[model samples]
Target: MVQLYNNGAYLLNGTEIIEDNSEANAKLATKLGANVISKDEAATGTIAYGILEKHNTSGNMDKLKIKFDKLTSHDITFVGIIQTARASGLEKFPVPYVLTNCHNSLCAVGGTINEDDHMFGLTSAKKYGGIYVPPHQAVIHQYAREMLAGGGKMILGSDSHTRYGALGTMAMGEGGPELVKQLLSKTYDINMPKVVGVYLTGKPQKGVGPQDVALAIIGEVFANGYVNNKVMEFVGDGVANLSADFRIGIDVMTTETTCLSSIWKTDDTIKEFYEIHGRKEEYKELNPAHITYYDGMIYVDLSKIKPMIAMPFHPSNTYTIEELNANLMDILADCEKKALVSLGGAVDFKLRDKVRNGKLYVEQGIIAGCAGGGFENICEASDILNGASIGSDEFTLSVYPASTPIYMELVKNGCVAKLMGAGAIVKTAFCGPCFGAGDTPSHNAFSIRHSTRNFPNREGSKLQNGQISSVALMDARSIAATAANKGYLTAATDIDVEFTNPKYFFDQTIYENRVFDSKGVADSSVEIKFGPNIKDWPEMPGLTDNLLIKVVSEIHDPVTTTDELIPSGETSSYRSNPIGLAEFTLSRKDPEYVGKAKAVQAAEMARRENKSLQEALPEIDVIINKIKDNYSDVNNINTGIGSVIFAVKPGDGSAREQAASCQRVLGGWANIANEYATKRYRSNLINWGMLPFIIAKEELPFQNGDYLFIPEIKKAVEEKQSEMKAYVVGNSLKEFTLKLGELTDDERTIILKGCLINFYKG
Candidate 1:
């Protein structure tokens, strides 16, 4: 169970927690006599503050400009990131960059595009002095953990799960534009984030795994936004109880809590992790000051955490497996009701049909990707299934090691053989399963996985095609226990099994022989390879004095994921080509979105060509005529036409820039939402030169396909206006207010110039 602090708390010597109540100062005085410190002074004692102070270059703690020691990206993202940097006058990488091909490793989806991306990464590494890891070698984060991570260092990745706090490294996962800035020697600008303490106590039970603990924590904090946009600093007695791998498993899932980054109190266990990976010198002991203050605290009793499951469509919809079985019908009914909201009644989603003899059955079990692919998780899974067989009757199991070195060690230690003997198919290092690229299930089938997310359509089910499947997240041990039951949902604790905890031996020979490391030496003579499908970004128009944008798609879903915005799995191959990838925008969520956006884009195309906007789209005349009724100065010359989307909450998952860039390429000028789910998503919109508009939660003034015009839009942004007036195009132009929220000066310039690319071009 997790307990949340209602008020700020102080940690005394990293063990005792003193709540910041009325008598909190008295308590601190009782312990420290006259040595008590001010709240602002004590806040600097956190491990996060220490690491950030060393990396911050702004000379001001309130506003941060961070320069990371290294950078990382995967295949589906690296191609676009390098292309953007190349366009922005990149000669050689300023910092060490690693391009790993793990997302699109399989070339089966889009012909030669996958391999072409790999080749491009290799050549870019050679041309720009970067590192490239070939396909089937290692995933991005795992490789970073093995090689790139250094204690007390900062790393920025283009993946959301970029967390190395357990290794005493403060890492952040952000959009590709952030990486491009790092490649160009630009600082990552942000306000100093608040640090939250994850105060741990006691020890986990035998059957409890890291994922269970993580899910329990996520379930408690995600909805309430307790740690949102804050750095999670782990402290207290529980820090020494968990192993390094256990801490890592819990750390990587911190992204789900919407925290900016995380850092833990590092000890000998973390030092030994670096030693095992042949980087003992990279290890550094990190701890908080004797007395520290946290804006918020999450006190987790590890012993009380049971085996939990995150039900379909979200990582926060959690329930204990025992409770789920006891209340099967009610939970299944509740899931079906939530599915109606997530799926929009696109397909008939029913979990009741999966019940047989009062037990739920699943079609597949996957222990793959960064969350479950760790050495200890896989080894324990194999131990649980040592003598048990995963029967081959409408049920299958698959395992993927996070890196080739892990695979080699698993093979050497007989874990892979034991898994294979139990009818489990073990594969190489790939992030496909975690996304939607691999192990797509049949229609309406249920899958149990240990991957990062279980969002809708992330299991490769196309809602447009009337193919829908659901996934439930569990720990690797529980998934293996379910597989042993031949897909019957079973918790690992229900089965009496002794785990043969094996000590891992990391083999780095695979990476030494296969990976291409540029060693920070650039060659100007090298020619970068380009595939036919890979293309440069299209020209974008700057902000106009007056804006006319049509609401192309309106989504009322409580939260919209990036997967629904641009989709993954099949469309990942087209990410290198901006215009081509734009065609798939909102393809699954709204099939007519591309055509609607394209229709609105035609008027902008005509405006740029100095042609008649009325001829391009006949409806523009009516919208312009209605707008001219109130403001006679609004004309075609000063007005720009584009499309926008309104959602309740948008950009929930994924750090892929395509979520916003695809909209930009399709002539999207703005996004109207009640609130943004993540900071990375809002940053993507600003980086792509799109307006991130905020509207109230009341009834809408306009529906989809209605034109809303904003006068002096560019001037409003230049003036840093908090709210701008907009008129829905109707008989008299009804008025409404749209907020721009908070924008940095650089962000305002980026919006004025069009995008990051355009700002750099200017």
Candidate 2:
């Protein structure tokens, strides 16, 4: 029985309850002896509060804008941003920025391609007077956790799980456009988000993991969108029962819930976490008011959570290990059905092959990244696999701790030794497994992972390349159980074992020895490294009077993940090189996408070179001349030409800026979507100066190879208009209205400026 932290509650001392206040706590808490929120309060408290206050749009929002230091992205994304910002006239970086090189840590593909991105980052960090985190020292989240996170502060990353709320920071995972707003010194605007209390009452059972609890919560709230876009504030007795490491393990996975951010009621355990990390000064006891009122609540009894698994496609697709064992065929069939939506007929994908002798057998097990690589989680996995070999068969296990600190602690406690004795490969902190650059499996392999995502092609396989693999989300305990059985799927609950909570000793010496901390200094003498593959961003033209987009492809998948757009594995290293990486765009989903996009782009290039449209692409001339007959204003004028793809759902994983840039490189202009997957991907589009247009879910009027024209696009974007008329050039021009979602003031300018990079091109 998985007990959730039930939110529907009245504060009680065993049954004696107290009711909430009269008005919205955000408003009421500030009035009459409390701090009136005033919708627009700036920093009245600390640096963190100042950042939060600026974004609180209800009151005097403008006055709070001056506080932020700056915003940043990395090599995996900055090229597009810099290109766009430069198009808008970027002169110099406004604030202290950073460009890290952790994503393309695997340098196996395209030869020196990953290093090129790192060199580009080093140069950009120097040129822009920002920081640069070299590769392999830490994963993105772990590095951010150690260096960037501050109490009560706010940071928006292009990565979807840009949350670090446990450290008293109000971090958000948003698209690139939001970061552009910050880099341009513009405030982020949003309606105040509803805060939901996740009240945990009981302690967790043994052999369970943070991934299990997170999966359990996701299962409860995901399907119905109960906690979507809401802040989950964890509180209550169960919070006291869980150790700081355990709490953090669960906290890291909260981003998968699609929530804005999360916070836990800070206690001595939290304080100790800061002290152990050698930042005791940053510790502060954070708690809601005695009469706090949340919009809603989720109740979790930690003791009830058991070994869990989120089958393929989504984190929300969850069931227990026992449930999978009890009805293997039925769930396996369900997964196959889901594959139709996820894989989109790309390959024959299935989970049924894992079954043998009435039990499931997994080919691989991994414990890595922010969600799984904690000291406690690794120690537990080590204990479970104590003297058991993973076997000489296809079954294998690997473990990666979050940081050097955690890794050093594991070694100090002999957890590394134990894992090694048990045949588990312990590696450094790299996000490759989570994004598929490492530990690639054979075709039709099934892997259980404790990493962040298991999106299609995220298992280090390429469908177009005739390689395919799949993964299931699971805790180390259960993964170990399956490993111990030499590949038979087994639940931790099936075998009882004692879990000894061991104390961790932090050794910062590793980071102190290896990490180069600039401590916020500007060194002009440092020559930026510009590798051959890392070229300047293509000159993006400003938004024209109208947009002519050729629909190159249409994706009907419920969601189109970034991995599908610009796959994982080898391609991860080329994010910094725009044109080089663009060649791989839509390479996996539609192998012919690049050629098709390039064909349309050739027309745009010809136009740039002052060649006649009729002379370049005779087919485009016929379509445009037909449109000119209807709308006299339509002429072969100075306009940008690009290709567009309509996906039912897109922007699902990784905040790599390239997802949108590749489209821009291929002469793409706008994306017509039913809905976007995460905030980060949408922001990536807007920051790249692409029009994020949406049409009704059922009313997709345009098809591939069709031309769409939207007149007065820049004006329409400037003045917020949900509906804008777009023309499809076919037999006769069929006009359809597409909707542009809400955009903040800075966001509008970034689009007008062609991107944040151009905007900052001072």
User: By TM-score, who's the top model here?
Assistant: 1
Which pairs, if any, clash in model 1? none
lDDT tens per residue, model 1, 1-762? 899999889998888899989989899999999899999999999999999999999999999999999999999999899999989999999899999999999887778998999999999999999999999999888999999998899999999999999999999999999999899888889998999999989999887889999999999999998998899999989889999989989999999888999999999999999999999999999888999999999999998999999999899999999999999999999999999999999999999999999999999999998899999999989988887899969899999999999999999999999999999999999999888999999999999999899998888889998999989999999999998898999999988888888888988888889999989999889999999999999998899999999999999998999999999988999999999999999998899999999999999999989899888998899888888888888876889999999999998889999999999999999999999999999999999999999999999999998999999999999999999999998888889999999998989999999999988887
Question: Could you give candidate 2's per-residue lDDT for residues 1-762 as a string of tens digits?
Answer: 433333323332221122243443433434424543332231122223334664564475433343333354654666556544545554456666656555676677777767776776666566656667777667767767666666665666667777777776677766555566665555666545556667787878778888899899988876565666677777777778888777777888888777877776777887887787788887777665444455556777788888899998778889998888899999999999988877767788878877888888889999998888888888888777787778889899988888777888788888899888888899987777888888877899999999888888888888886677988999878887777778788877776566666798877777778555455555666665766676777877677677788999888877788888888677766665678889999888887889988888888878777787766677898777777787668654645677888998788666677788788877778788998776667777877878888888786788888898777787788787778998998888888889988887766776887765665663
How large is the C-alpha RMSD of every model relative to the true structure?
A: 0.9, 4.2
The reply for model 1, stretches above 4 Å from the true place, is none
Candidate 2, residue 443: lDDT: 94
Which residue runs does candidate 2 get wrong by more than 4 Å?
Answer: 1-51, 54-101, 119-133, 175-186
Candidate models: Cα lDDT each: 0.93, 0.73
Q: Candidate 2, overall lDDT? A: 0.73
